[model samples]
Target: MFLQRVANRGIGLGTLLERAARRHPANILVFDHDLDAAPQLGRRATVGEAADAVADLASRLWASGIRAGDRVVVYKSDGFDITLLAWSAARIGAVPVLLSPQLDGATVETLMRRTGRPHLVTDGAKLQQELSEEVFDASQSVLLVTGSHPRARTLGSFAGVERVAPLEMPPDHPTLITHTSGTTGVPKLAVHTGRTLQARFRPQAAVTAPLRGRQVVAIHVSFVHSRLVTALAISLLRGYPVVILADGGTAHVADLFAGLKPTVLEAHPNSYLQWEELADDPRRPLSGVRLYSSTFDAIHPRTVQRLLAASERPAPVFGQLYGQSEIGPSVVRSFSRRRRQDADGRCVGVPFPGMTDVRVVSRNGRPPSAENPGYIEVKSDGRIVTYLGEDERYREQVTDGWWRMGDVGYRTKWGCVHLLDREVDLIDGFGSTLAVEDRLFGRVPQLAEVVVVPGADGRAVPVVCTRGDVPLDRAAWEAAVAGLPPMAEPVQWKQADLPQTATTKIKRLELAKLLAVGAGQEA
Candidate 1:
């Protein structure tokens, strides 16, 4: 089978850095923020130094009684060390359950309870500010990455602890656990094995195979995401020097990219949206970038057009991978500098032949089309084994080995998938809310974000955030929405006020609730 042919065995996350060091010990890693676990090591380190830090941290975790087959939950403040801590936990054969820093205290407690009293690894700010004191009570034992806690011992306290050999587990053993985007409700824990993760890496790595040796690959994925693990691994193992961003602020990114001039860039779609203004920067921060890559959601064509126009490289391309946390990237679509600005943003792209398959099932007993969309189902070796502690819930998504993506879309005659709206977010008679949003983005240059959600009255409502919170030009909006599906007057809100996932995807359902009550949401 193609799956087994691509990667017959699992890739080890624990010794990833160590393995990379063997081939490229001097490969440099630049960081914007200092690592909390190894502050003395500073913000920069070589592959060799990074490997040593992971090994050192693993010893500390072992000395603290984290053994093979155990689960360790890392819920510290935002830092690259969150990923390094995951590596360290895996080094000792303990499964790493990563929680996003964006998750609220109540949500964390719910996840901790779901993990069934797993050992918690966190920091001072979370303990004092965000998390409840009961977190300690819900954990098997709490370990601190930073700050003091009487109930927890600092990870650094075990600095001089004896080091142990890295334990290797079978390919099917649960390697990592990451949560979903939590757009609707509490996020579910997605359990991943080494084999499944490596399957995901294979397709993504193939995307970068065309690049030449030693391109400066800068990554800005969330620290706790499973994609970060494979993104780092692919770069490190391939000997590409890396630049990791802890902050996605425009000024910080401009200053850094002006100096380093990365060749390849990877970030979430919304992050790219946030950096659209960087195109006009005098320094041409994206000048040297050859490829712009994003995964997990559909990107706006307007955002793609602006970014590609900013790139000075010959034949720059924007690659979008449309999939979910439960299933790794199922389809890919790439946009080039020459592509028209009105390119169909809904056509997410085609599946990888032999490796991944996609099918849209009919909903109304008719062939699915733009008028009547259907459920998007996909099959891939990269699919997560199950939702941790929610086996039945996971089973509900799988039917005869195919995973339902919980998205409604139709396939084009050329085989491209047109993602319309999420299953739960669909509005009756409002043909494709996403297509409407895409058209709005293309029509309104001043708009930063526009989400179409159903109001309590079942009318489509557009929630808009202007670029700089500037007052929306009412005339421009009126002209933009002309001849389109009818919607309530645009509700203007500050971008920060919008409920977003860790990946920066706006929560449309949550936004709808806020607008349903007519709480003066208009700007």
Candidate 2:
């Protein structure tokens, strides 16, 4: 069945789910957080059940006047229902724009305005709060609330609606819209078509084909992101029973893993950093994990080392994919116990031979060499067509066929991609913040995370978090940074206080702002 589907010209995003349901009727589709629990637990559903739910919801959306080519905005807290509803909208040929609930009301409002006031699907509680705060404009949108509200129509009202047949869309029809993490500025909505999504998932499916139906897969990432959709496709197509984790707190993940004992685990890098302590936990939550996958950003070597060691599986592997929201996964690398200790976190491996073309072009237009690092550019078939409502901005980043990655890095003599820093976050005196942070990892065993950001004087400053308030060893720190740039006295911050995107990447701009304020108080 899978072989036949792959031969099709293009598969619609909604069709993918429907096919999965037909192929694996009793296969589990979702494990959502239980609302009534003190320590939240998950509730399970089979693929057929989930497909029915999507059809029911799609009918309600169509009854609400949404039609082909119409836009529907889904703004809700993290939950399986958010993903289900997004796919439901797609099933009816309505483009679904998924916004993270973690985004502030102002950001949400800004995104809504840019999308031209589409129909909004949100919970009554969130709608009321945003409305009361004057951040959301009620007059511009028709509200579809999950819970009862005076000003909105409840989703429950359409619960009894008959299931509607899935709509057929052209391969290039826009099906999903999601925003960037907003690390630099207001997030831009990235538009994706079914063809683009299929392009992205094809490579992933090929690589993991060997593990199909044999591994229990567990995922803890933002449901609203593009990666989640790809993940769902991979799990469903491969017949892997999935455990979706909405709450990524260490305790919740630990509890879930203890019960499920997944053999394959995928999450944001920072999430793995937070779970390093589980390596030592008596429960041994990660013991059964054979594969650990991280995307979005480069992960620290120490974090990777610890996780690989935690897995009792003899040959545990860590897979890292370095790419952006605009383009799908570009470069890929795998780490095993043999290479764990000597792994350079900055080296993100080479681009897939046929999947992408990568180049490092210097500021002066010279070809990149090891010594002369420059901005990284990539040309991939899976790249997004354009940013919704920002064609000019999108075009600015694309020159000819290559897309500027907004990153500064150089390719090694062996063709590996070594990331230095985000173009905006590069500290003038410091070579690479990621490289510096990697060096600091082993120097202080208790240091959980260390970030180098520009200070008020424009010099590099290190902000660190130690495990359980372990005092920093001044002598060790001085020795570790011996030949490196002179850094400002390290500022201590609680791990939870560091601002991060939904993908678990530290907001370097925000961190710099925080440090500058601290410098002022000291003065």
Q: Which residues of candidate 2, in runs, are more than 4 Å off?
A: 1-8, 30-32, 35-42, 131-141, 340-342, 365-367, 469-475, 519-523
- Local distance difference test values of all predictions, in order: 0.90, 0.79
Q: Candidate 2, residues 444-472: lDDT per residue as tens digits?
A: 77788898889889988898887875667
Alpha-carbon deviation at 65 in model 1, angstroms: 0.6
Task: Give one digit per residue, the lDDT tens place, for model 1 in 268-325.
Answer: 9888988999999999999988899998799999999999999898899899899889
Model 1 CA deviation exceeding 4 Å by range: 1-4
Error of 1 at 425 (Å): 1.2
Candidate 2 global CA lDDT score: 0.79
Best by lDDT: 1
